[model samples]
Target chain A: MLEIKGLKAKVEGKEILHGIDLAVPAGEVHAIMGPNGSGKSTLGYVLAGREGYEVTDGQALFKGRDILALEPEERAAAGLFLAFQYPVELPGVTNATFLKSALNAVRKARGEGELDAMQFLKRVRGIMKSLGMAEDMLKRGVNVGFSGGEKKRNEILQMAVLEPRLAVLDETDSGLDIDAMRIVADGVNALRGPGRAMLVITHYQRLLDYIVPDRVHVLMGGRIVRSGGPELARELEQKGYGSLPAAA
Target chain B: MARTAQTSRVTAPAPALAAQLARYAGLKDRLAGAGLPWLRDLREAAAQALAANGLPTPRTEAWRFTNLRPLHDLSFAEPVALVGSEAERAALALLPALGRWRAVLVDGRFRADLSELDGLPEGLAVQPLASALHAGAAGLDGLLGTLARPDQEPMAALNTALMEDGVIVRVAPGVKVAERLEVVSIASAPAERAIAFHPRLLVTLGADASLILVDTALGAGAAAYLNNPVAEVDLAPGASLDHVRVQDEGPAALHLATVYARVAERARYESFTLSLGARLARNEVHVTLAGADGDCSVHGAYLAHGQRHIDNTSIIRHAAPACRSRQVYKGVLKDQSHGVFQGKIEVDQIAQKTDGYQMNQAILLSPEAEVNSKPQLEIYADDVKCSHGATVGELDEAQLFYLRSRGVPAEEARAILVQAFFGDALEQVPDEGLREALSALIAGWWEREGGAG
Candidate 1:
């Protein structure tokens, strides 16, 4: 469902992601394990069409269409979601208002009728129930004073509400405790289906325990150096990235 | 006057002051309450003070960031009698109907035909300043031109010198007026000539009384004019007042307003000013906490586009022990518009345990757009706590990207963030109905100036 061929990007004249090729087919989950400054977050940002990231070469294709040329909002309407590692805190804007605006925008772009306040609230309440979030969180400002675990869970809650075809989870488990990780993992596991795909990017193999990936790829020096089955994560966890053989 | 100016080391009055003196010389005989000896003496004294100080210039310390050259160059003619026309009525109809008690003033004169004063509660008195002066109301003698000083505010002094007509609202002791009172001022000049008028408003809340006052300044035509208004408020012990002022004058008009309030023991005074239109506008509020345990808060939001200029200046004094005051003002400027915020908090020596806070924030949408913020705190008491801060910046790029990434368009995202920025100050409005009304007005302004740009 998502393809990246020879994708090269830079920020502020410094190349972060060198030539790279990766693909995650429909209904399959993939994990990209990379150390710090290995361009994992940069790839997520580039796919989401963030500014200041210059795409010097290659193209990102989503459903056989060039996704790189579209605006961020347009990409969102095309069923592509990027769950940020650090969610922004929008002061004075309630979480309910933000979610409603976002949901209605995507729905309107897809030529679907908008939902009234009551309908939207009903849907959000069910999502909040599964995510283990209190209803009061919806009334407060968007992540204004939310805890780290709450922020990460809020990102997943947004992912579930939007129900995108392809989701990119960028270091979602970095700052979460074990219990928070289990909750987030359960939230992600609930959305797994044959029509959707997810790319779980993480630094450690602990997150892969709960949400097992179909394939694991090790990213080093801005390029995927090795690809293998789920056992590869266990192998790397046992033998760190430094013990891996050099790429051919 | 010349000797006083020299001895006091004040700047010499500019030529604009001479012109204004000449103009008022012709209108003094026609001024309201002209036959009252006391009122005549008050006007004469205020005229002398205005002549001594002249119009504030950029060279003046208080007026450093705001240049009044445009006002100085324009020659203002005396305001002529104007009745409400169809267009004027249409403009009035567009105003938000947030209050039940409405008083309309046209060209600085009270429009009795357009006002609704019936069904007023007992112990409440509302009337035009002219009528009150004519009837020689019992308490009106000491309240008019008493709270706002002439030496510190030249524009207010000018207003007092040529005061024409305004409203007088009074609530008796222990009375609580549930309905919000709205005073609407509409400026419609006779022609393209620059006309000037001064409207004076007096509000008095007796001990334990509570009231809400909404002052709306708007215009009908594109004619050049000046709408200078002065409002004096006196809150007795344990009384509370909520004042909301909206200045949306015509594009070619200049609006200058000054509000003076004296809060007594245990009283609470809150004010919010929304400035959205006008060529050049300045809204100054001076509040003094004269009684112990009093509370005062002044918040404002201003939006200026094109070549507009808006200024919000406030001075809060904590004269009584254990009083608290807060000031928050925010502005958004686009194109070549300019915004200025100068706020000062003073804690007197005898005012122990005083608490004061002030904050000013601004967002400049264009490179050419400018903002000048100055926050000052003067505390003479060792036991007082006072803090002030000011910030000027562009919209957060990260916040914008986050909103856009969630499917909100760029324009919609900007509008949302801008509204949120102003929401901080708008939340200070004590009344929910009035707050929603002002929020709608701000949204309308953003749609016009911040859409697809």
Candidate 2:
């Protein structure tokens, strides 16, 4: 569903992600574990077409189409989602409006009919109920004054509502407690199906226990040094990245 | 003029101001209520004060950052020369259709044909200034020239000297007006010539009375005319008045509006200004909390695009003990437009336990867009709570990216952010329908301006 080869990205005129190569098939979940300042978040940002994350030499393809050439909104219309680690607060825009616009934009891009107010409310209410989010959350400003756990959960709610074919979770569990992390994981796990792919980026292994990944890749020094299965996450959690042998 | 630097030193009036005085001299005899000795003395007094202090300019202390050179470049046709055609009148009748009691003024002339004052309630009265200026008009004893000081505000003095016609709104004591009252003023000029008009609005609420006033200023054509209005509002004890000012003129029009409000004991004066259109405009509001426990809120949002210049200047004075005042203003400037906000809160010596807050913020959408924000607080009472803040900034990049990544188009995202920036001030509108109307107007402006492009 997603492929990246020779993905060399730079931020502020300095190269961050050097020669990254990865592929995730449909219906699969891939986890990238790295220490602090390991270019994991940079990879997510670069793929999401965020400004200032310059790509010197790379091409990221989603569903066999080059996504590096698209704008951030255009990339989202092409079924790409990036769940931010620290979601910015929109002071006056209600979450319902934001979600409706996003959902309609994506649906329009996919040649599907847009959801009216009643249909949108029904679909969103069902999803929010499953995610255990308060119904009034739709009335409040987008991420304004939301707790850390609530923010992460809000991100998941958006992912569920938009139903992106591929979602890039950028450190979604950074500030979440055990219960919150499980809720986010459950939300993500519910979206897993044969037509969707997810790239989960995290610094710790606790989140992996809930939404167990199909493959694990160790990102260190701006390169993927090792690739293995679910046990690799536990192994690194026990031994730590410092003791792991480099296999790049 | 609470925060204005007046009376300490004097400078010669500007050429533009002198020319206006000359125009006033030419039209003094034709002014309203000329035969009335009190009105004549009041006009002369204001004219003398205006000659001394002159009109505000870019060089004026508090009037810096706004250029009035455009006013000097155009010759103004007097209000008497302007005659609206049936087509023009028809076009204007569609303006104040908010489904309430409305009074429409075309170039300072009260249009009884277009006004919706038939089914007014018993305690409420709306009349033309001509009627109020006629003989046997007993209500204009102290309410006409009391609040709006001609000596302090030159534009108001100009209005006082040349005031032709406007609406006089009054509510009886202990009467509550359940419906909102609207006064709409439209400016137009003869072919190929710019025009200027000065209208006076008198509002007085008796003890325990309450009313909502929507005062709107709009233009007719693309002529570079000037719409200057002076409003005097007197609120008795325990009275409440909500004043909403909407200034949306033509592209080449200049709108200068002044409002003076006096709040008595336990009374409240709440004003929300939405300055959307004009070539060069300034909306100045002065409020005095006269009696104890009176409160006032001066809040607004100014949207300037397409090289337009808009200014919002206000001064709120706390005269009695335990009065409260708050000023909140936000502005958005795009293209090469400019915006200015100067708000001051003053607490007098005997006004102990006074609580005041002021905030001014602006967002510049382009590199060439400019903003000048000044928030001032002067306190003489020791036991008072007062604070002020100002901010001038561009949109946050991270916020934009966050919105764009959520599938909103770039322009839609920018419009949303700008509207959000203006939300704090718009929330001050006390009525829900009026608030929604203002928000819809802002959205229309955004779309008209090509949505942040």
TM-score of chain B of each: 0.96, 0.94
- Fill in the DockQ of model 1: 0.79
Best by DockQ: 2
Model 1 clash pairs are none
Q: Which stretches of model 1 miss by more than 4 angstroms?
A: A245-248, B1-15, B189-191
lDDT (tens digit, per residue) of candidate 1 on B1-453: 988968665554556787888877887887778878888888888899888778888878888988888788888887666645886688888887868889989888899988888888997888999887767655667788889788778998899898878999999999999998899998885566888889999999999999999999998888778899999999999999999999999998889899999999999999999999899999999999999999999999999999999999999999999999999999999999999999999989989999999999999999999998888888899998898898999999889999889888889999999999999799899888998999999999999888754
Candidate 2 TM-score to native: 0.96
Highest lDDT against the true fold, candidate: 1
The digit string of per-residue lDDT tens for model 2 on B24-52 reads: 78867766677777777888888888898
Query: Which stretches of model 2 miss by more than 4 angstroms?
Result: A245-248, B1-15, B80-87, B90-96, B450-452
TM-scores, chain A, per candidate: 0.98, 0.97
| 10 residues in a row with least lDDT, candidate 1 chain B | B7-16
